[model samples]
Target chain A: MATTDKRDPRVVRTHNDVPAVALRLLLDEGWEAVTPVRVATEAGYSRATIYTHWPERIDLLRDAFAQFSEMPHHEASGDAELDLRGELASFSRAMVEHRLDRALATLAERTQTNPEIAPIRNTFVADGERPMRHTLRALAEDPAAEAALLMLTGMVTHSVLMHGTPPSDEVLDAAVDIVMRGLAQRD
Target chain B: MATTDKRDPRVVRTHNDVPAVALRLLLDEGWEAVTPVRVATEAGYSRATIYTHWPERIDLLRDAFAQFSEMPHHEASGDAELDLRGELASFSRAMVEHRLDRALATLAERTQTNPEIAPIRNTFVADGERPMRHTLRALAEDPAAEAALLMLTGMVTHSVLMHGTPPSDEVLDAAVDIVMRGLAQRD
Candidate 1:
C-alpha cells in the first residue's frame, strides 16, 4: 500500500519528475519549441498538476535553472587568492559548458523586466555572491577582499555571457591572470 | 542659400533632426513606445522621409546609441590610478543617470533572442568595446589592461541593468576604489 502522509512521497516524486522531463524536452528542442501543454503531455502529468506546481512558464524555467545553480561549489584550498581564482575559473567553465546556458541567460535578462522573475534572479545573484565573499575574506587581506571578490565574479561572468564561443583555455587562463594582477593587494 | 557646395546644409540638418527627435521620444516614453510613425510625427517629418533615412528601426536605434557613445571622452587627470578611477565613476554615473538606460537594456536583452536584432546588438557591443579597450590601455600597464577594461564596463552595465537603480555616488566611489586598487601597478 502507498503510505499516506501530509507531504506525500509520490508528490515529491511527481514534482521531481516534472522538471526532469520538461528539461529533456528543452534540451532536445529549444525554448520557443516548449509549451506548457506540451510539457505536461511529455511529462505524463495533467495540465492542472503542472500549473499547481508552476503557475507560469518563467516559473518552470526558473526551476530548471535551479537544477544547475546547485552545482558543487568549488572549495578554496587554503591560499585564498589562488582558491578564489581557481573557483572562478571553474564556475565560468561550468556555466559555459552547459548546453542550456544561452537559454538561461535569455531568461535571466528577461527577468529584469518581468516583475515575477526579478526577485528570483536577485536571490540567485545574492547566493552566488555570498560564498565568494566568504572565500575572499578567508584569503584576501581585509582591504582587498570585497573588491577582489567583485572583480573576479564580474570578469568570469561577463566572459562567459558575452563570448559566443566557449573561451579557449588559453583565453580563460589569461583572463584569470589579469584579474589576479588587478586585485593584487597594495600598500 | 544657407549652404550648397558639396553637402546640402538642409539635408544635414534633416539627417541630424531624425535621431534627436527619436532620442527624445525614447527617453520620455521608453523604447517600447517608439515607432517610425511616432518619430516622424514628432519630428515634423513625413513617415516616408523617416523610412528613407533609416530604412530600419535597428538603424535608428543604433545611431542613437552611437551618438551618445561618442560624447567627449574624458581625459583622466592626476595620478594614473586616480584618473582611471575618476573616469570610470564618471562613465558609470552617466550611464546610470540616463533615463533611457532601462529601455535600452530591455532592447539589448530582446536582441539576444530576436534574430533580426542580434547582429545589431553585437555590432554595438564591438563598437563600444573598442573605445573601452583604448581607454584601459592608456590607464593601466599592459598585461592586465584588457581585464581591467572588461571588468569596469561589465560591472557598471550589469549593476544598473540588473538592479534597475542608479548606484549611489558612494557605491560608485567604492566600486572605483576597489577596482583601481586591484589594477594599480605593484612595486
Candidate 2:
C-alpha cells in the first residue's frame, strides 16, 4: 500500500523553511552573511540538512535569487511602447521592492574576482533579462532590441545605485518614453 | 647653503609608484584586495609612506579611482547630437580600456553596506556624470536631462557587464542616435 503521511514534518519543514530563511537572511544581512551554518541556526535546521540539499553556498544564494527573480509574467500587449513601459515599471518596482540593486552589486563585486561565481551570476542576469528581451524583439529586430534591452537594464541599475533608492514610477516612465522614442527613430 | 634637489628620487617614486600599484591591484584582484599594506608591499614603499599620502583606505581607493577617472576633455563639435555621440564613444572606450565596469561594480557593492565609503563613491559618480548632464541640459531641459543622463549611464554599464566587454563603436553610435532622436522628440 502506497501511504502518504502528511509528508514527514522534517522534510516539509526543510523544503519550506530553508529557502524562506535563506531569503530573509540575504535581504537582512547581504549575500556575504548568508552562510549554511547561519541559515541552519536561523531556520532551526541542522547544518547537515542544509548541506545535504545544497552542497554549495552558491546553490543557496542562487535559490534565494531565483525566488527573488520570480515576478508576474510581463505579456506584451502588441503596443511596443506601452509594453516597454510596463516592463520598465515592473523592473524598477522589483528592484526597489526586493533590494535587487544591492544583491546585484554584491554579486557583481564577487564575479570580478571569483570565476566560479560568474556563471551563476550570469544565469541570474540572463534569466531576469529573458522577458525584457522578448518584449524588445517584439518591438524591434535583433541587434537594436538587444541594445535597447541592455540600456533599459543599465538605466534601472544606475538609478538605484546612484540614488541608493529604487527609481520612482515617474522616472521609469520618462526613461521608457525616451528609449522608445529612440527606438522608433531607429526604425 | 640649503639646496633643493629637483625632487627626491624616493619621494617621487613613492608618489608615482603607490597609485600605479594600487590601481593594478584593484584591477587585477578586485577592490577588497587593494589595501594600504598590499599597496606598500607591491610598490616597495613603507606603510608609513603610503599612509602619509592617504590617511584612510577609502582615501587610497578614491585616489586610485580619481587617477582612473582622468579622461581627455571631450570637446563638443557645436552639434549637440554629434557631441553626445562623441561623449558616448569616449565613455564606452574608457569603460573598456580602464576596466571601469569591474571597479564601479565593486564600489557599488561597498557603498551599499559601508556608509563610510558611500560619499566617496557618490563623489566619483557625480564627477563622471557632470559632463553628460551638461550635454543633456544643452539638448533638453532639467528633468529630461537628468533622466537621459541616468539612462545613458545605465546603457553603457549594462553593455559592459553583460558582454564582459565595452560596447563597440557601432553599438555606442546606435545608442547615441536613439537617445538623440528621443531628445529631439521631447522638444
Candidate 3:
C-alpha cells in the first residue's frame, strides 16, 4: 500500500474518490447499480472525466475492487504452515466481520452470465493468493501448493459465508489440519 | 424418492405441480420473482390454494428446494473412503452440469438476512451429507465425519462456483485427497 506518486493532489483525490463512490454504491444497491455515469454523478465528477478514466463498464469494477481487494496479511513466521494457517484464519475473521461474504456471494451470482467479471474474480483470487501463496509454496511442490491454496481458501470462503456465521474453533482446526497434512505429503 | 401416498391423485398433483413451476421461475427469473401469487398465476392454481400450500414467502423457496435438494448419490462401495470420494466428485460434477452452482450462490446470498433460509441450507446439507456421511462415519468419529463433510463439500462448492468453470481432475483429486487423508487419521 505504498504510494510514492508524484502526481498532483487533485488527480490523486479524484482517482481514489470515484472508485470509493462506485464501491459504496455496489455495496448499498448491488453491482448493477455501479455504472460509471452513476458513480460520476454521485461522486460529483464530470461524466466525461469518469468515462475517460473508465472507458469500459467493467473497468469501474476493476478500479473499485483494486482499491478494496487488499485482504488480510500477516508477518512471515519461521513455520510457513503455521503462518499460512494464521493468515487464512485472519482472512476468515475479516470476511465475517466486514460482511464481505455477502459481497462475495453477490459477485459469484453475477459471474454466471457476465464473463467480464472473470478477470475481477481472478484479481480477487490473486490478492487472496498473495496472502498465502508464498507460504503454501514453502510447504509443497508446484501443483501441490496450488492445490493446497484452493482447498484452504475455498473451504474458508464457502464455510464462513454459506453457513452465515463465523467458523467454530473445531471446524477451523479440522480444515487447516487437513490442508496442512495434505501439503506436508502430497501423493 | 419413494411415495406410497394414499392422498387423492388430484391433491398430489397440485403439491408437486406448484413447486415445479416455482422452481422453474426461480431458475429462470431469480428467487425474488417466485412469489406465491406469481407462481399461482403461472401454474394455473387459485391464489388461495397457493397461500394454503406455501403459507409464507419463504415457503416457496423451501418447497422448491425440497424438490431439488437431492444431490448426486452413489451406490456404497465396501471401501468407504473410495465411495465417499466418488460421491463428492459426483456432486461436484452435478452442480456444474446443472448449473446449480449459481443457484447455490444466489441462495447463499439470501441466507444473510433471511434466517428462515437456514433450515433450507441445513436440509440441503443433510441431503448432500447422506450421500457421503454414512461412509464418512464408517471412516471417522462423530465430529470428524461432520468436519470431513464440510471440507469436502465446501471446497468443491467454492471452487466450482467461484471459478465459474468445471473443476479440473487434478484440482478435484487434490481436494478429495486432502480431506480423505485428513479424516483417515485425525490427531
Top model by DockQ, which number?
Answer: 2
Model 2: residues >4 Å from true position, as ranges? A1-13, A72-79, B1-13, B73-75
Candidate 3 per-residue lDDT, tens place, B54-120, comes to 8997888888877666444677877766786687678777786655776677777777656778788
Write candidate 1's Cα lDDT for B1-187 as tens digits. Answer: 4445567676687778888777767666656656888888988998998898889887777666555665444564545556555665665656656543444454454554566665655665565556556656775665466666656555655555545444455544555555555555433
Per-prediction TM-score: 0.77, 0.85, 0.88
Query: Candidates' DockQ values?
Result: 0.29, 0.58, 0.51
State which candidate has the highest TM-score.
3
Write down the TM-score for model 3: 0.88
Assess candidate 2 and give its TM-score to the true structure.
Answer: 0.85
Candidate 2 at B18: error in angstroms?
Answer: 2.3
Candidate 3's C-alpha runs over 4 A off are: A1-4, A41-48, A185-187, B1-3, B142-144
Ranking by TM-score: 3, 2, 1
DockQ of 1: 0.29
Q: How many residue pairs collide in each prediction?
A: 1, 1, 0
- Model 1 TM-score on a 0 to 1 scale: 0.77
lDDT by residue (A6-95, candidate 1, tens digit) is 677878877778777666665556555456788889888899988988898877766665665666667767765566666766666666
